[model samples]
Target: MNSPDSAAATATAFDKARTGLWVSLQKHLTTVYEAETAFAQAIAFAEAFPFAASSASPEQLDLYWQRRRALRDLFTDETNQLDTLNKAIRTKGYADAEKKQLYLLLLGYMDIAASIFERLHTEVPKPLPKDDELEETSARFERVRKFARLNVKGIFGLLATAAQ
Candidate 1:
């Protein structure tokens, strides 16, 4: 566990780009979490109201493909950002607990985001979830998501407050 002072020191020691990247990572993480929540809600909505057609119309299917493509693009972009972050971490000489923050960002958020892209990309004609499943998914991810949000917020605050 990193102390607040260490966090402050770490943030202050980095150049503006490094600090800004850290904040961007936190914001991206929050977006990832919110995206997951929205996805679950969409599933729940779909479960309640089944699609009118047994199969999607060409336009509808095209829309799905477009969304999947967009998600893939976003995931690719995030991965590039993560590569930048990893290099920055290594360059900063952060060891021990300080490095753990990267796991929270790179794995907790980015990995999950990537998995979402994979799942959507691999969806067969209608890979629908069971009606009851989304509730469980929401419950399970919410706790971890909240924890991540809090820690990321704290870290960002510490970083932002640090003197340049």
Candidate 2:
């Protein structure tokens, strides 16, 4: 029932979609890491030198707040990009079942990444430091580890499916 041309067209579409998804994901990840590093530095700075009016300048404290705001803004921008990518994928028509499944899995993964960013935004110390900061940090690392494992498995699955 399937013509060679149609099959080729489908393959092209699938490849294009996959590339877009992965590129978007990579950008999101880079932003996440940058934000995380800035966050950790801010926290360390705060903990090391308590912001006493006598000890620290108003300008120094202002710089810290500025960095925090910038990180929050970065997350917001990333969330918007992810939402746009999600919409594009959802609107696209996937004719092949295997390709569709792969697309759907990727869409789900993007959603997870967005959720992680949302959590990161909320947890970003608007005020800084709670008793549970350490616990939260540990949990975050675990989540990243699990996500990394999923990424590896997903890539291998895609390769195997393509090989067939």
Candidate 3:
């Protein structure tokens, strides 16, 4: 028979994970917002001047190079934070089922971000993303953020019952 001590410990572990995940979501969401804004602004700036894009090769343009560097830097930072968050949960002694669920949720969030960034990085220089596409990507990221915030709590509560 499972002991109440284990249940209590599980609850405590979940409480800590939930709190840390909340913080991570907040920070990651802020970075996502900033990166989206910065990338759009960079594209707009390049478009406004017109002549800045005057090159036989889009890669030769200064603004193009600048955006590439920016995306690379942002992606590097995000990867590091993602690694840290994964490590935190693994060492926390959560049940395997809960751990897998959390991992999948985190990956979903990361995929939304990576999609936006990758689309911008690839399409921004020459073709420029369609307004509809940009809107769709923004909407997708919003959905991911909202879902992550709401679902993580329920997951924690659900796992708490398993403790019993």
- What is the overall TM-score of model 2 with all chains considered together? 0.55
lDDT of 1 at 10: 68
- lDDT (10s digit) by residue, model 1, range 53-133: 345556665555555445444555555566566556546666534555654654565546656644543443444445343
Give each model's clash number: 0, 0, 0
Best by TM-score: 3
TM-score of each: 0.49, 0.55, 0.58
Candidate 1: global Cα-lDDT? 0.53
Order of candidates by lDDT, top first? Answer: 3, 2, 1
- Residues 96-140 of candidate 3 have per-residue lDDT tens digits of 667666766586667767676764535444444355644554455
lDDT of each: 0.53, 0.56, 0.61
lDDT of 2 by residue, 1-164 (tens): 98999889988978877777777667767777777667556544443333443344566556556665666566556545544544455466764354455555555555555555444435443345553643454354345434433444576676887899
Off by over 4 Å in 1: 1-11, 14-22, 30-54, 126-164
